[model samples]
Target: MSYLVFEQVTKVYGAVEVVAPFDLDVPEGELVAFLGPSGCGKTTLMRMVGGLEPPSSGQILLRGERLKKPDRRRGMVFQSYSAFPWLTVAQNVAYGMRYRRDLSAAEKEEQVQHFLALVGLTDFASEWPNRISGGMRQRVAIARTLAAGSEILLMDEPFGALDAQRREFLQLELRRIQQEEGKTVIFVTHDVEEAAFLADRVIVFTRRPARILAEVDVTARLGASRTLELREGTDFFGLRNELLHYVRSTASEEEGTA
Candidate 1:
């Protein structure tokens, strides 16, 4: 079985469908990105995988087991800094473990501290959300998600709100973390370049009521790890332009049919 599978999936609200029927399979330990423009159902698809939303029709399976509701098996990072303003960074990270019966208070503290350091925020553990910069807050969000120890991560443009430099920095940091931990991640972003830099494969989607337009495997010479230099190469643009062309062609075809 695939590590993650979305089989003949569709989502609808009343009479309007938000996502067309689609099938996608992600292999174990792979990082894939769903790339498209705004309102193209990328976030919706991520939400389904995260168990925050259910498909109107079709099945979502992880490791061959059907996913029916939210569980700690999947971690998620939102585009917004979702930390509670009143809570300390440590408190924010520990919030995810409230339902777990396995960890003692000492163990939870240890895990929280470990994750805080993982995201380079051990020094700010006692600060409230408002005292931190936007980038730092985003790091806290990542640390919180990581602390949950979930095997799969569903990220919805986690660095979208940051400055370009910070976003790029975090992308490299995320690649390092994913490699060290061997986690399967599905990241959503509208930026094609971002997808190319971070993904093992990129799934491009059509506009509203989105469906997979094309799936491109990037064959850049990053040599098993992502790097900024890879993004500047000719091969990167070649793959990216191909995806852009496919998306445009699909959009035009849909318009013609309508």
Candidate 2:
């Protein structure tokens, strides 16, 4: 059975339908990217999976059980830097663990140290969120989410605001962390290259009411490298172009219909 299943899920707002009946099965530990043009409902779909937005119809099942509300099992990192402004880096990373009754004070501190080190923020543990760069704040957000023992991550363009160099750096870091931790991830992005480089499978969506236009498997094409070298290769560009084509075609179709 799939770890996460969307059973005929749809989202409607008044007379406007954001998502059509959508069905998907995501296996455990797979990184799936939802790629589409703006207003395509990809972010809306992520919100439903995170349980922040209830589906207008149908159900989302996690491990064969209905996902009813926001819980620690699913962690979300939005495009904005969501770290607490007043908290130090360590404190921010430790924030999520405070909710867990399973760990003692010492254990939580250990977790904070471990995750801070994992994200290479150990040296800046005492610094405030405002003192760090945007990319570092996003790292804190990721560490905090992981410290909460979340089984799945819902990232909505988490690196979208950063400069190109920082964005690529975080992308590699995120991929490494996700792989090592073996967590299922649903990454929402409009960038074709970002989707092609990071996802095991890329699901392209049409304009609202959004539906799947194409599902591309990129794991095989990724080969042994997950670095800039891979992005520079011909196959990577080919896959990215294909995804772009699908997105453009969807936009063209929408324009014609309008």
Candidate 2 residue pairs in clash (backbone atoms < 3 Å) = none
lDDT of 1 by residue, 1-258 (tens): 678999999998888888999899998888999998788888998999989999999999998999989888898889988998889989999987877889999999999988888888999999999999888888888778777778899999988888899989998889888888888999999877788888888899888788887888763434557777877888778877877777667567657742
Expressed as tens digits, the lDDT of each residue in 114-193 for candidate 2 is 99988999999999999999999999999999999999999999999999999889889999998889999999999888
Residue 239 lDDT (model 2): 93
**Consecutive 10-residue window with the lowest summed lDDT within model 2:** 220-229
Q: Between which residue pairs do clashes occur in model 1? A: none
Provide the global lDDT of candidate 1 against the true structure: 0.85
lDDT of 2 at 249: 91
Model 2 score (lDDT): 0.92
TM-score of each: 0.92, 0.97
| Shift in Å, residue 227, candidate 1 | 1.4
- Total residue pair clashes for candidate 2: 0
TM-score of 1: 0.92
